[model samples]
Target: MAKNNRTLLLIIFLLGIFIGALDTGIVSPARTVIASQLSISSSSSVWIVTIYTLAYAVSMPIAGKFSDRYGKKKVFTLSIALFGIGSLLCGVSNYAGSFSFLLAARVIQALGGGGIMPVATAYIGESFPIEKRGSALGLVGAIYGVSTTLGPTVGSALLNLVGNSNWGVLFLINVPICIGVIITALIVKDEGIVKEPKKMDVLGSIIVTLLILALMYALTNLQFHDFKNSIASTKVWPYLLAFIILLPIFIIVERKSLDPILNLKYFTNREIALTLLISFITGAGMMGIVFVPQFGENALKLKTGSGGYLVTLMAIFSGISAPLGGRLVDKYSPKLVLSMGFASTLIGSSTLAFIVAKNPSFISLLIGLAFIGLGMGFCMGTPLNYLMQTNVDPSETASAQSTLSLIRSIGVAISPNILIGFISEAGKNISPKLMTILPKVTIPGSNTAVSMTQGGSSSISPDQLAALQNADVTTITDVLKQFSGSMIDKFSPMLKQQLQNSKLPKGVTADTLVAQWKSDYLAQIDAIRSSIENMFQSTLNEGFAKLFIGAAAIALLGLIFTLLLSRKTKPVSSN
Candidate 1:
């Protein structure tokens, strides 16, 4: 390939990754609007993301096998076309206001989107010489990292610029880009690396797909709030049982198949197996990156959207470190580079778990984030892909990359439930604490300080008070804020009625007493609101601290896997 052709190919690959990853998060900001317009419950609307993840994970190995067996260029082109068609359908679903249509369209979109990364990666691994491979693959990894991290921010910017009515533009905008990529992909000459072909392992593919789908389905449905019950429920256990039953069946099928979709040898090779394990741990650690915004809101009490800016800051470091990490891999052994990466993550997550989480501050958070960004840049991309590419045969390069991605996706999929379970369990006392506050709150504006529990004397009715006590931790702050306002509104009318029935003293007018009462009442309500907010914030802080602690544990596990890698770098094979 000419230099210009490689550059164009790289550009096309980057664009594919960007659009696909961008869509992964782009729907999040608009989820509520989508739900309202489609008349779906907020909880049900999560399926849009859930279904895409499941499809994306399932398609990875199949796509990789297709690229390896057929050709990268052809599969790349087909994948882009599928993605484009899916985007079109998604846009149409928005117009039609059909949630089911949108979900089906998302599955098509994910099938294409999932294929792009590994296939593009196989191209880079095969196309580039060993010396340049790290840099090229690292750059690809950086784009993927940055794109996924920035997805929500970009979505928000688009939503703000175009407004909610134009939400479909998010999906529609991909059509032109996909068409352009497909055209370029068609024009690019396939490298035509040949190997003796065998029959496609259709059964192996089916079993693996079913196996992954069942496992992911179970993980996605695990309700963090009701963890114990949810695990025992039909939503989780049935799929889990399916996965367990299918695992041995998949192994048996792959073992007998001459040309398996996933080469069983990769698992048998100790180095590759360790590398895959490390990749899984790395994916779990990367979950910290995803939750950074929520962590900011919970721990630091940052404004709603401002947390994304912190992610942008981390992305800048991640983007820089990716190429730098790749360069380091080219210089030193991968073991050394990987060890350094995991250590950085361990330090970063520990800082968050212990120091910043305990005493939330901007400066402390920045220190922790910087280390995490550096760690993610190092571990997530170049090292893992480089190992997979080098370990497997050229014919299996795409399959190898896909297998790596599939395992990592499982880690990414599972970590949230585990981390969130910790947070949820820690904050279970939030409602009880809130109930204590409600009963004890005394309104000072009354002739005698009145208890909030005194229904007839209080502006807040008993039913409304009970509702506040039952509020979920996620929405308690907003619920309390609204409750405060409604209480004040109710107080004004109630006080006005009281004044008409009361006898006034000589110097004081009923109007003056009413005004004073309103003033005092507002002050009291504001104080009460502040106290409730503080309690909620405190609970969140405790929850997030545990979340970060769990993340740190994952990083530590990655470090252990890093230690399990071959101490010496193997010379690149010239196959």
Candidate 2:
């Protein structure tokens, strides 16, 4: 009876991990809405998102060791409490406050919530036998999938629920759940403190934390502020230089630390090392797929709220593919399961480029996204099992697994940032096009086009207004396409010229014309979109091809790592 109850408790605590994960995607859908109403930039709210994950990245490995020393239950309880605090703070932040405050609070929230997963994994593995491990791991993955799916939906629902009460409600809602998760964690007892030669290395932890954080900041920011253009700027130089300096320090410190945050000994083992590398390699390309739907809807001229559905369609495929791959891993071989998953994504990315080359249909997204999602699900979990079985004794499965879990996490952070670097590199040649007609273009903040405020002419009849609106949509789209294509075609030269000149047009007199240009730019977006919508299928097909080409190329890297795997993989043993 006690054992069964512990299982229930651990399962409940695992839900808390998704509380943080949900926040990752939750703020994503609501970003534009929140940023607009707050009179701030989308760039501001995006930090509300990327920063949390960034903070979480630095916090995870630290959390695991703290759990090891202090006890999982204590770490678990503290994490939820902090998560609740962070959520409440976020919900209440108003127009009067600063964005920096929110980021600071998120980092604190990260410090608090980081240990929940590693600790939860630590405890659950101790409670369950090896026979039950795979299923238990699957349950955890399922929970994550459910959390990620529900994140956007919940975010959307909360936005509506509060009815412009603002994004505070999304944060506020987590408060109650965190309260509940905490109570359950407190009721659970601590278990296992197997004394080994290893000791938790505090200095090593700090070095690794700094190293990862610097690298993460460097990668995520690279696209937004490219090194190519602004290589000399402090933003690029400071972070990148710090990363370069600290990385060698981290590796050296880890070698000497009594308990290295990362166990380098594993690097000597070909199978374990290679499989983990495969995980990281394949993950590198997936970063964009997660956010592509948002870009497609918000930036690419698709209607709002449509982005989530587009993402959902792809997720549906991945969700379906993962379980099928799981079964294959169980029945056939982990090698085949992983290799096929990587291959499927490669094909899917290639197909996606073609589908998205034009402004494609929502249904097409369903097919392409499903294929990739399925492939990911099939391959994701079995790698951890390989890590668990191959490293350490049977008695140390949980510890070994938690160590690998931390590595998987570092990969997750590193991979997306790498892909962001790639995707941004792809768009380096691309440019944001004007969307609407010039004469009608209502420079956003100004009132010129009916597109901005609607019904440009007070003297015009209703029928005329309707006709104007129809024509305006097409005109806006045409201008936008031409402008965008021009931006891409001449981005390199244009940027270079702009840097050299660094001057606005003759009439413009402002510190930052870029901001004003954005408004006009957004308003003008329709001009280019009509053409895009007409050629949607072909355009998306092209986009899909480009995206897959990258995903596949990266997966082939993963495939090479898999080739380094041993001749035989261990099957799922009996429970």
Best by lDDT: 1
Candidate 1: the clashing residue pairs are none
**Candidate 2 whole-model C-alpha lDDT, 0 to 1:** 0.59
Which residue runs of candidate 1 sit more than 4 Å off their true CA positions? 298-300, 431-519, 527-534, 571-575
Could you estimate the TM-score for every candidate? 0.89, 0.74
Alpha carbon lDDT of residue 197, candidate 1?
A: 73
lDDT of 1 by residue, 1-575 (tens): 67888778888987887788778777878888788888999889989888989999999999998888888778877888999999999989888989999999999999998898888888877788887788888887788878877888888888899888778888998999999999887787666454467888899989998999999999888866677899998989999999999999999998899888887778778888898899888877888777788777656666666678888888888888888888888777677778888888888888888888678888988898888888888887898998888887787788889999999998888878778776666566665566467533333235465443345425566776666655543556556556644665566676767766777777876667766755564465456776777787677677777888888888888888888888765634323
Error of 1 at 71 (Å): 0.8
lDDT of 2 by residue, 1-575 (tens): 28767765766766775786677668766777767766678667778767776777777766665665566667678878888898777766744355666677777777766666656655654555544544455445545554665578678877777775466677777888888877776776656554353566878878877877777766556543354765566655787899899888888987888766666665666666676576566546555466555445633456545566666665566566555554554455567767777777766665565654444455565566676676666555544454345344433343345556555665555555444544444332222111232334333233544342243334344653343233222243553434433333333344345534655567654424544554455444554455544443233234334555666788777777776676565532211
